[model samples]
Target: MKAENPKASAEVVWANNNTDDASLRLWREQSRQLLLSEAKARGLQSTSPCLCGSGDRLRDCCLRPLR
Candidate 1:
């Protein structure tokens, strides 16, 4: 899926049909963290395009809401 859409979320791409695999699960978590870090580094404005390149505003797109 990454080849088709490099910005696709790893969780959505790497799902194991609701079953879990240790390596894949760890990889998904790590990928999420990495993306989150990159997003923080961008520190984009609400009007700016999302870092994911989905054409949505940064605040309206992918990253998890920080608690």
Candidate 2:
């Protein structure tokens, strides 16, 4: 799905599934935080294209409602 739509985040892809598993939710949150931390460490700016390959600014894409 991501390959088909670069703009789709993992959350977006899994949104329809709606799992109640605590472990899975924790893992997803941790992974998201890790990715964001790594991006910050790499000096990614809000105006930079997202590493997710969404072709959208980081702030507009994965960084939405965060940074």
Candidate 3:
């Protein structure tokens, strides 16, 4: 499913097409926030693995977006 933000798709494509860590990080942070929000809405615990499937705890992942 596509994200609600139209620009997100373009940004993802651009980030994938280019080897830019800044852009990629920005996209990743946005994705993390979205995933976290969705998971919270669905009553998922923060101690659970991130909804993004990174295998890290949701609280840890979202709290430290730079990682």
Candidate 4:
């Protein structure tokens, strides 16, 4: 099962009702952009190991662009 968002459910609900696929896609893109910006802010390199300790490089894992 996918992990639930660490953010509040109500917050997500208010952002863009998860019931809609388009809304979900938009939300995910927004989240991804934010994450990339944050990584850049911290000087995290694309080739660095993932912070998740998944034994994969960032570009090959979390830092990869969304599908």
Candidate 5:
């Protein structure tokens, strides 16, 4: 399968390699925070377009609340 965001992947790798110990520590913490944010987002209501350019509100469309 093709990568969705090759640029982002490259940037992440560069950031990881160039970061100092303290910066890397902060990056790890931020990554953890992002993971938690995404987990919480899985349940939160979304009434906007999708990442695929589909102009559908998630809660009203594909990612709608479980019935």
Candidate 6:
């Protein structure tokens, strides 16, 4: 199973009224945009990934080479 959202632990509260595909899709797209914006704001290169448990900082010692 996929891991739950650490930031959004309350599932029912967030997905209560919306019980349709369109609502779910909109939520997903908004979530994606939020994540991307947050990543960009943190100066994390979109190409490289942070894997050392230090979030996505580029110099966090777990920065992998960009593909």
**Model 2: per-residue Cα lDDT over 1-67, one tens digit each:** 3434666454443444565567556766776787688788999877888987879998788666332
The per-model lDDT (C-alpha) reads 0.61, 0.69, 0.68, 0.64, 0.50, 0.51
TM for every model, in the order presented, reads 0.47, 0.50, 0.46, 0.54, 0.39, 0.47
User: Which window of 10 residues has the lowest lDDT sum in candidate 2?
Assistant: 8-17
CA lDDT for candidate 4: 0.64
- What is model 3's C-alpha RMSD? 7.7
Which residue ranges in model 5 land beyond 4 Å of their true spot? 1-8, 11-17, 44-67
Best by TM-score: 4
Residue clash pairs of candidate 3? none
lDDT of 3 by residue, 1-67 (tens): 3446665453333335555878767867887677767887988988988765779987787556534
Candidate 3 segments exceeding 4 Å error? 1-17, 49-66
Model 3 whole-model lDDT (C-alpha atoms): 0.68
Instruction: Judge candidate 5 at residue 47 and give its lDDT.
Output: 56
Backbone clash tally (model 3): 0
Tens digits of lDDT, candidate 4, 1-67: 2236554234443244435877666766886787678768878777777665777876788656443
lDDT of 1 by residue, 1-67 (tens): 2335665545454534555677666766786677667766888555678786779876566544421
Please give the RMSD of candidate 1 to the true structure: 5.4
Assess candidate 5 and give its TM-score to the true structure. Answer: 0.39
User: lDDT: which is higher, 2 or 6?
Assistant: 2
Clashing pairs in 5: none
Rank list by TM-score:
4, 2, 1, 6, 3, 5
Instruction: Rank candidates by lDDT, best first.
Output: 2, 3, 4, 1, 6, 5
In angstroms, give how far residue 17 of model 2 lies from its true place: 4.6
